[model samples]
Target: AYLSPGVSEHQVLDASYLASLLENSTSSYDYEENESDLNSLPCPQDFSLNFDRAFLPALYSLLFLLGLLGNGAVAAVLLSQRAALSSTDTFLLHLAVADALLVLTLPLWAVDAAIQWIFGSSLCKVAGALFNINFYAGALLLACISFDRYLSIVHATQLYRRGLRAHVALTCIAVWGLCLLFALPDFIFLSASYDQRLNATHCQYNFPQVGRTALRVLQLVAGFLLPLLVMTYCYARILAVLLVSRGQRRFRAMRLVVVVVVAFAVCWTPYHLVVLVDILMDMGALARNCGRESHVDVAKSVTSGMGYMHCCLNPLLYAFVGVKFREQMWMLLMRLGGSDQRGLQRQASSSRRDSSWSETTEASYLGL
Candidate 1:
């Protein structure tokens, strides 16, 4: 039960129908080329088949630029310190790499969203695959980073430390493998299908009904929830450790943990909630109406955009916030200042009071 201030019945009804077909799974589903459905749909004036053509592309452009610069800086800084990279830094590097991969596809989607899918068929599939692969990869890498931090803090046993580099490498490999495996659906189902009404091709997934429902649920659980749970568990345990060892630093750890968790939830939960509601409504579990469906359709677009912000946020929350990273960046700046800046380097080196900076920094790298 909802109402828009301005909309016609045809607009509302067509919006509802288009919403159903957007992320839906159906054996009989095809592009809107079927003239019968298109004739009836008539492209709603209120909630057109396409999202806000201007706003969505602008958002994508913004995310692409921010993600590129932020993730690029992270990768460059991390690689520059390759010889001294800790386990957290290694995971952060991979996370940046995954973010860059996802960002690269945003411009393509931006163009497609604004106008039409002019990329033809093959590139459409490749773009779709890149979207799915790097999405899963980024989430999986975040969870991996959390788990690595958990192990180092919660159970820093000698055995665990033995061949730690190898362990980190292997874990990253496994994450990529799982991401590509999960994204196999895109490879199989994502393609450019012609829509007659629009007389344009769209890059989208075409899953059977049951498969669509399952994939939606799987994405909810695997793409977001499971990774969230892993991060929560690791942070909770890490917080427990900090609480036991009482200090001002403990409070900082608590704040960082809360900030990280809250940021993630705020950024991602709405999209998943909208998706879940869509699934439920489609299954007749929720009261369905044209008005509500239209609202949800609008929501799905906005929430999905919000979710993409994670690529830009990752470097800030997970990489640049570390004390060691901040110091290293400063050192890099000093080094980049030409030969006359040698004094800055000497002062920077002389200011290091703790021989155990690496150990302490590892603890802080998880936003300590």
Candidate 2:
């Protein structure tokens, strides 16, 4: 039932259709009775119930496993690279930590999905808070990484020695603070309740009218719009800097940033847009007619799938596009295979030479 960023729309629609088919028929049940039973329930609630029954537990199980392994490995690798902890790495470490925390909540979600939040009120609050906190923290850390890249490239000489460790720590604190503040509503609003029609107990949010509207608005701005704006601006400036850089090495760094930022944007933007639309629909700003409802349901299914897909994408991004990360991964693999380590040694030597050459070229450019 949770919306994620990587699931395909077709898969969601197919899942939904399959769920509907399952709920409506059995070899022994009469078609008329099945139709009558379905018609008696609220469409949205019935769809949600069916969807949860059919897909959510399995989906959460898969995500939990993926997130656990991927994020755990990311955290371990980032932590082990203590000597290479630049401002960029600092942000990345925080991002990995945030993502790992989010993964920790997945098991709870899986339980809730399968068994309808039998964990009670306190667990509900804790799970909801952790989920929101980690999600927003991850987003904020991504923005921080983008800004760090922008500054490192565009203001390289001036900011090169700027110690961002303390600043990054402070910013992380602020992000957590804001995340908690925003997430308080989830604590106050979400509760486990019994669904009378379905004869099932479940966890659900119960926002006051004003609070619900505000939460939706806040989600649109903080969760989607603000981060998008910041990432877009930083990457745009970074791209401009890269395009004009005289050094091939600098250009290469910029190109890497472009790929990272572009991948993030492409993966996340649709999910956010769909979330905004869902909020709008909830607020009655969108029509509630059958066609619109169907459209919204379809959109929800697609967006949720995509959002889940996002969780698996970050590790791939780091492994493939991050030159340092790729090197580290390759080294780790070679060690595991007990293969020749000469290639890694050669790469290290080549990297040192490249660094020396870059320094010389920079000195020449500055007439030093």
Using lDDT, give the best candidate's number. Answer: 1
lDDT of 2 by residue, 91-164 (tens): 66677777777777777766665666677878777777778778777777777766665666556632322254
TM-score of candidate 1 to 2 decimals: 0.82
Please write out the lDDT profile of model 1 over residues 1-368, one tens digit for every residue: 01101112233334446766554546676656565655444343445345547467889899999999999988877776676566666778898999998988888877776776778778876777777778888888878767766776777642224246887788888988887887777778766665443445566555555776777787889899999999999889888887897667778777877777777888889989988897897577998665676677677778878888988998888766666666666666667766446676564555343211223233453443
lDDT of 2: 0.60
Q: Which residue pairs does candidate 1 place in steric collision?
A: 33-196
Error of 2 at 98 (Å): 1.1
User: Please, what is the TM-score per model?
Assistant: 0.82, 0.74
* Model 1 spans > 4 angstroms off: 1-51, 158-162, 334-337, 340-363, 366-368
Each prediction's whole-model lDDT (CA):
0.69, 0.60
